[model samples]
Target: MRVLVYGSGQLAQMMYLAAAPLGVIVSAVDVSNETVVHPVSKEPTGVSLQNAIEDANAITVEFEHVPEHLLLDADKSGKLFPNVASILAGADRVREKALLSKHEIPNCPYLIITDVTDLDNVIASLGERVIFKASRDGYDGYGQWRMQSADQLEKLKSEFAKLDLVKVPLIAERMMQFDREISLVGARDSEGNVSCFSLAENLHFEGQLHVSVAPITDLSDSLQSQANEIFEKLATAMDYVGVLAVELFQCGEELLVNEIAPRVHNSGHWTQQGCDTSQFEQHIRAVLGLPLGAVDVRGVSAMVNIIGCTAFSRDLIGIAGAHLHWYGKEVRTKRKMGHINVVADSHSHLGNKLAQLLAFLPVEHFPELEAEANRLKNYTK
Candidate 1:
């Protein structure tokens, strides 16, 4: 079997690696140039876009932001998994909010803004603190602004007034007092069968994910069930088939939907070493009608993203169950260079592994590592 993925990034590379052992070939498209490229080496494959589409057994995206014209062309092949509408819902906040509201899925209270005058009532409707996000092409802290006080409204409005709001609107979300951010990554087969990995607790710095610990300490059956129900509602509603990730904010026992990713997600990277089947493989299975793999975890796991800095000691892998996956990209500030996944028998052990792994890393690039290690070091349940 062969699959074609729409974005030639790390996710596509991972998918290619995972599919190899399954007797499947995965190729990627560079959306910018419409050329098919090798998923790992990223060299041009010299294959035409139309020919690649014809050759693929299935077509999917590594990210939601693929060009609409390209997505429409892929959809015409009748091989696009999760479909064009689902991808669009993920790419645009307006469509995403509408999808949630249409299905009665709980999400952050938000208002759409197409004009600067809309800011006048934001403080009245949502409150003083609001997070404004671009309706499209925003991720990892870009295209976002936060308003902390009523006095800052004019300055924000002035900045926003310079943009073409009608073409790319803003979504003003009322900030919620949530305890921690968590995500559910799951796959739904064409037959509607669903399998979900354990909920992962995520830590972010400057809006980029820094660390994620899976099977969060003190995980409750009720909490897992609630997350599953939310997943079921959204997946079934969209007729989604492939790996889907839902990021949630936990306000005590309630889970409020923050955002959804229509493709494999960064937060799910832990599954590569922690679970019976990696998310990349599971996504391939789902899109190709293969039976879903077990979601059972091997042990407690922590996935630490290696952001921006590449000078870390490679010997960190000497620690048992420590594995590194590098993206082989040129380093840029706040860019995800690679990730390290560590699995241990228990949370405390996992924390110790992370703490040990810290010695090899430069603390400046990983600001949250120490605190997260300390938090998990004494966790009991």
Candidate 2:
């Protein structure tokens, strides 16, 4: 079997790695150049994008920011997994909100802002604090602004005046103060067989994911059931046939959908070392119409993103249970260089190993991380 994945990034790299053992040939397309490349070798042997897609048994995406024309063409080929409609929903926040509302899936109350004039009413209704997001092409915290008060709103208007809100529009969501954030990465087969992984606790710094812990400690049964139900509703609604990620905000006992990722997600990266079936393999299986694998947790796991800096010590490998994944991208400010996954028999043990691993990281970039690690160690003990 062969799979053609859109976007040549780390997710595509991981998917390619997972498919190898299954005897699946995974190839990637560079959306910018429209060149077909081998995902593992990163070799550009010069195959036309159309030929690559035509030869694949299935097509999927590593990210949502695929070119519309390419997606349309793939749709016409009848090979796009999760389908164009689902991909479009992920690309635009307006479409995402509408899909959630249509399915009665609980999410933050939001307004579609066609112009700056609409901001006034949205603020009055949702309150002083609101999160303004571009309806399209926004991810990893870009194209987002937080309005804490009327003054901030005025500043944002002036700062973003060059943007034609009327043309692309924006999504204004009520800034929610949630107790914690959790995510569910689940897969749905063509026959609608859905299997969900354990809930993952995520921590974000400046809109980028910093860390994730699997089987969020003290997660209540009611909340788990609610998250599962939400995923099922969305998968069935979209007729989804691949891995989908649902990010949730746990406010008290209630969970509200924060957003949906139509492909395998970053937060689910811990599953690489922690689950019976890694999310990459699960996604490939689902899209290929194979039976979904077990979502069983193998152990307590923590995944820490290696962002921006590339000066970490190679000695980090000496730490027990530490696994590193480097993206082989040119290092730049705030770029996600790689990630480290640490697994243990229990969360307490995992926390300690994380502390040991942190020692090998640059102290300048993660000043408070050492302190936070100490606190976690004490708490776990």
Candidate 3:
């Protein structure tokens, strides 16, 4: 089987690695230049976009932000998995909010802001503590602003006025004091069969995911059930095919939807070492109409992201059950360099492994590792 993926990034590269073992060939389109390239090495394949689209048995994407023109071309092939509407919902918050509202899914209270004066009513509607996000093309803390009190509204409106809100708009969300953030990663095959990995508790710093722990300690049956129900509703509504990731904010016993990722997600990266079948492999299986694999977890697992700094020792993999995945990209501030997946029989063991990993990683870049390690080291249940 041959699959062509849009947006040649780490996700596509991981998919290529996973697909190869299944006897599937994966090629990636460098959306920036529209040239087909080898997924890993990124060398040009000399295949035109049209030829690549026509040759592939399946078409998919590593990310949702592929240009509209490219997506339209792929859609015309009748091979694009998950469809264009699903991808657009993942890319634009305006469409995403509408989808959630239409489906009656619980999410943060929000107001759409298309004009500067929209801010004047935000406090009355959603309260003073809120986050403003670009309705399109915003992620990793970019194109976002926070207001803790009504006093900040005038200054915020001035900052927002400089931009053309009419073009992109803004989504003002009421911030909730959630207990923690978690995500469900699952696959829906063409036959409508679904399989979901264990929920992963995510930790983020400055809007970038820094670490994810799967089969989180203290997990409850009700919590997992809630997540599964949410997944089924959204996936079925879209008739989605391929892996879909649903991000949630856990407040007490209830899980409110935070966002939906229409492709393989950063939080699910723990599946590489933690689950019976990695999410990358499941995604490939779904898009190709192959039988879905088991989502059973092997043990406690933690995925620590390597962000920005590359000066750390690479020998951390020497720790038992520790695996490193480097993206082979040039380092820059806040850029995701790679990730480390560590699995253990118990939470304490996982914490010990992470503690050992810390010695090889610089402290400044990984502010949460030590704290997270300690918390897990003493964790119960």
lDDT of 2 at 121: 84
Find the 10 residues in a row with the least total lDDT in model 3.
135-144
Count of backbone collisions in candidate 3:
0
Question: What is the alpha-carbon lDDT of model 2 when measured against the actual structure?
Answer: 0.88
Q: What is the lDDT of candidate 1?
A: 0.95
**Residue-wise C-alpha lDDT for candidate 2, range 187-275, written one tens digit per residue:** 99999999999999888888888888888877688888889999999999999999999999999888899999999999999999899
Report the alpha-carbon TM-score of model 2 versus the true structure. 0.96
Error of 1 at 242 (Å): 0.2
Clashing pairs counted in every model: 0, 0, 0
Candidate 1 versus truth, CA RMSD in Å, comes to 0.7
- lDDT for each residue of candidate 3 in 21-43, tens digit (9 for 90 to 100): 99999999999999999999999
- TM-scores of the candidates are 0.99, 0.96, 0.99
- What is the per-residue lDDT of model 1 for residues 123-168, given as tens digits with 9 covering 90 to 100? 9999999999999998888999998888899999999999999999
Model 2 misplacement above 4 A: 379-381
